[model samples]
Target chain A: MTEEAPAPEPRPAPGLPPGPFAGPAPAAAPRQHLIVVRVRLPAHLRTLVQLEKETERGPGHGTASGPGHGTGSEVTLELDSPGTQSSLLDALETRYPVLIGTIRDPRTRVRRPFIRFFACEEDLSHEPPDSDLPAPVLAGTEPFVILGAMAGG
Target chain B: MSTIRVLVGTRKGAFILNADASRKSWEVNGPFFGGWEIYHVNASPVDPSRLYASQSNGWFGQLVQRSDDGGTTWQPVGNQFPYAGVPGTHQWYDGTPHPWEFARVWHLEPSLSDPDTVYAGVEDAALFRSSDAGTTWEEVSGLRRHDSGSSWQPGAGGMCLHTIVLDPVDPERIYTAISAAGVFRSDDAGTTWKPVNRGLSSESIPAPEAEVGHCVHRIAMHPSRPDVLFMQKHWDVMRTDDCGESWREVSGDLPSDFGFTIDVHAHEPETIYVVPIKSDSEHYPPDGRLRVYRSRTGGDEWEALSDGLPQRDCYVNVLRDAMAVDSLDPCGIYFGTTGGQVYASANAGDSWAPIVRDLPAVLSVEVQTLP
Candidate 1:
């Protein structure tokens, strides 16, 4: 959970450093901790997002023994800074704008009735929006899962 | 070769039925955008290949879909319809002031000369237009911000602007109708409007001869004779020859005057069609028979065309926008029913046959004549 500043550019040798005209130290570009997280979307959301699957596997088709118990065609998403559920959703919607109101209400920001959120084999549905994601999910060892609940027979 | 396309909007999705000028056998295409309510689907008059659909659901809100190659493919368009300035209040169902809220689009009207320009009539009673081919929408605030708007009230179906009619002769004139609010006409291209319910009398309203609050269900006008309008009210069929300045009851001799849909023949300006329901409370036809009455002499006399329609134990309601007419030589007449049946008459109501029997209850039907 510690922030990692980006490595500073190698300083030019004494004579190579562009003399007195060198510009003010470029404000160490705000260290944006980019994290790549795997996302497992439900069947309905996968269709709504309309992302072409890289593999032939369908929803819940992957290994179920890992920290992320269920599997599907996983999409890798890149996020910056603290990767909370809210931030992750913001990033997902930014990439797939058509899903603005599909998984969450546009006005209320509440999850849809038949949708569930999970990670590390635990239901993160009720977790606070700003809470940090699970360690396994943050480390890319597990996927942030979006599952459609089994409602009717 | 000339072709005819019938766009049907149902409770679940939209279906496009295409056939040649012969109007004999149709090739059914789809239940496109399945599982979503498609309220209206209309083709652009200038560009037959351009189409627009109003897709919505209770859970996810409203969405506008546009197709460049007719209905072959579609992509979501803008759904943000913010009212201009402060959205004031209108009368709610109980006669109390209620804040204006954005509801689903009830009708989509593409421009006559420009495919990119379109208009939308939405619930909570507002009109919006998009000049960028449905990519963005801005409300034509003049209609909703009129002086009499505060007195506007919701009908049983909610205060929805459901009908839009543009004059073919004069591009400056526009007409729109709202349930429980009667009819309104704009002379300066929707920039301003005035109530045109002068002669409309409804017993359900507080005043029978009031300027507004008549609960108009639908209105139709043949492009050739734009001034002459046909209206189907909650209990009466009306005719207005003076650009809706005044109207006269033409509910003549029919099984019942209570009905929803009304449309004019494509070639014949005087010829009109209406499906009379039993009563306001009972939406089905009388004696459990389905009939579509045609009046060739404009309104006084009528004939029930039931040759190919059901006669016994068939009780189904036809919504206000479920009827349309194609502009072919023979001129086909079409309408869909609550029982999920779409019937078409090639020879103008002389006889009819079902196109597709099982669809979610049809909400609207529109036709395009293509060459």
Candidate 2:
């Protein structure tokens, strides 16, 4: 029985993509365009984000010049044209690196607990992660915010 | 009497829900007790007018509030717990602040012997007794002794004392259930504790024993017989006739023994209600079905109520403490789920009607007929 059989490992086609051995090409760059980002922080995190001061202190804090708190907490992002979801989240994270891991994954893009996103004044809580946010929210000109989700009980 | 009030505890605060008989129109007065995470919201059983709300502020400590006018106003009950004032705090309960200031309370039971005698279980896996109402409190020193430092544990949420059963005839013969830790008894009012977990299921890694860490989610007693218990354990629903000395699995016919709350008839000892959700690994309604089952012969047979339950794919998981049966003659059964829907069964569990929906995920459901 020992001398009867020695199986050979299967081989892939020469050039027609090495089948199982071939690596999937990196995901194509997400379709991009222009949009706005908004975050709604609970009271404690709003203070953590200096949202009150950002609102009261005016656009001076909007520029990325210093790091005193939320002073450097702006998000830069890419979008799928004006008034879209992907674009809004992209702009928010690009401007705020600290928010990268705090909200969506730096790699996976999943929303984190205590962190929430809203668009067009409607709570888009259970929407598909990659779905377009909303037409009104991605105007790129309106004031958008990023904030934490506060849950209890 | 003119309004039905529903108390909601949120991450930031609590909300007071006011509704009329229809239970349809709702007015939400929310974000109450700002910045304090309300864990348990309860109304005095004898007088629905008086309200009790417990809050946990993590590092800051735990706080409780009392309302005299149906949650229209509030006052804080924080300084009652003195353990937070000490230095060497013995064994840390739930691996957290031993007698945490902000330690959450899972059960707020008012003594049947005296309305003022309140039993509260906190994060430290300890039970507290307030003899003279909420004015002052003393730790159940006796039960704490039996905690068995190494074996005691908390649930996924945390180490918690979530269930407190106060005997109407004799408050001294009280029972308390802690998550991760099994059920404990204090026949002499929290002075001494012992293992009342006989017959209960605890299939944790290694093996099961009388020590602790059995993972009992909730336990209920026949309103008249304090010794008789129905518990929604980690894996099964069980019963103990001789006051936790011996047990039997009542959920044998159930597709899954996993559930959060179990309600016994306020008067009839044989009738009980159990809402069986799948176990933690397959956490969903049983068989992916939206059913609230009732066992008329003490869990021997079950009948699912779907008269008003949604036919849609409704798989809302309910918290253990969120479902209850009131003491009304036929008994009033009410339950709330994580998906923000509340159901009421006017005539026991024969049929159920959805009264409130589209609200915030409900944490607790406490109901009392009009005074």
Candidate 3:
């Protein structure tokens, strides 16, 4: 059998440019768009996350009063791309890992029965998690509010 | 100098009571994780400074908090507890197959030798272990996957594995008790388990004396004699000598055999304690008097230790995990009430006094004897 010619280098499509833009362009580095979203947590969760932050700071630094002290109820989170309930929560849980199963079910990713999400005066708890957040929440004008429903005695 | 730290888990939060060796004059420090239900808070037997608290809310689910410096501060640890496979089903209240769903942890049993090792008994009835302190948890599937598991049903309170006793001598031997599934023993650590309810009888179930399906409220064992277990069943007090191979009724002189908590003395293996409620339906003391019955001979003969306790017009129910003992000279005994009072007896239940009153309804009480 005749020796098969060495496989030729695959050429770009007929009308495509021959340089860097030729053929299937190398997977572009994912555009890094950082969006800072504001989140207002319930008092209990605020305390829980604050305690975690204090533990991270180590002993003798818990209640050190000054500017940049006190992780208040309203937290600012920096998220990458596609700002939706899912992404916002993913970012929130990433920053405060302790809040993983609190706001949503860890296994099902469903909002807890008694936990409600609101932004721009609209109930977003039942909205699809992948749906984009309201403009006010995305713009940091109105915080993405996480309220523990007025439940229990 | 010896000191005692009473870790009290309440309906609303956790309170850490510190007292000198005298077990008097308490210094209460908490309401930690306030607005949440603290099911059980326990300190590591190997490392007294390490503590674990199960903080949960109806709205937020469950979270395990770890404190390296006692309860001065706490950091949330791993809360993910995924079952082994498929998660199967257990019997529901109406005798229908109910999917096993994780609710919350009812008890946390830290290892007797290793500070990082701990076990969590959670609702829907299963046992989970965390070898790396509370950072991660893996279910001991053998117990839940037992042959008789599907037949298990929940008591009035949801189906929960509420008690875990580790053998101090045999590291591989572990015992656990569920609300309605009775007691189970594991000789190969938590790898394999068997129902140890041989002699347990529950009228509530179709088979009063089945291999499983007895509502075992609590079980207590002394470290010195791990094989001898004292159990507080739903309607009777039980004692097993051969490591749960068989159990016999020890509810001899108890005013009402229905009770929740049972605990063995820290130093005296033969001395045990139980708080007898009026009945299963009425969760209160027998005659509106809160009394703690002490059985110095290990049960069948009980004496009401109501010296400092309320003798009249007092109604409170002590939860299954709400009593504990300290390893001191006199061997202090402590129990909390659903009426928001934690009572302590420095002289091993001869008398009792409230260490703190008017707090939230206490859920569980644990003691750590610190050097």
DockQ scores of the candidates = 0.09, 0.03, 0.29
Q: Please list the C-alpha lDDT of all candidates, in the order they appear.
A: 0.82, 0.61, 0.85
Structural RMSD, model 2: 15.4
Best by DockQ: 3
| Candidate 2: residue B144 Cα off by (Å) | 2.0
Task: Report the interface RMSD that candidate 2 achieves against the true structure, in angstroms.
Answer: 23.9
> Which candidate has the top score in TM-score?
3
Q: In candidate 2, residue B157 scores what lDDT?
A: 69
Candidate 2 residue-wise lDDT, B209-326, digit = tens: 5556688888888867777888888888888888888878888677677888787877788787777887777556866676777787777577777677765687887777777666
**How many pairs collide in each candidate, listed in order?**
0, 30, 0
iRMS for all predictions?
16.8, 23.9, 24.8
lDDT string, candidate 2, A105-137, tens digits: 443465643344543444454466555544333
Q: Rank the candidates by TM-score, best first.
A: 3, 1, 2
Name the lDDT of candidate 1.
Answer: 0.82
Off by over 4 Å in 3: A1-33, A51-71
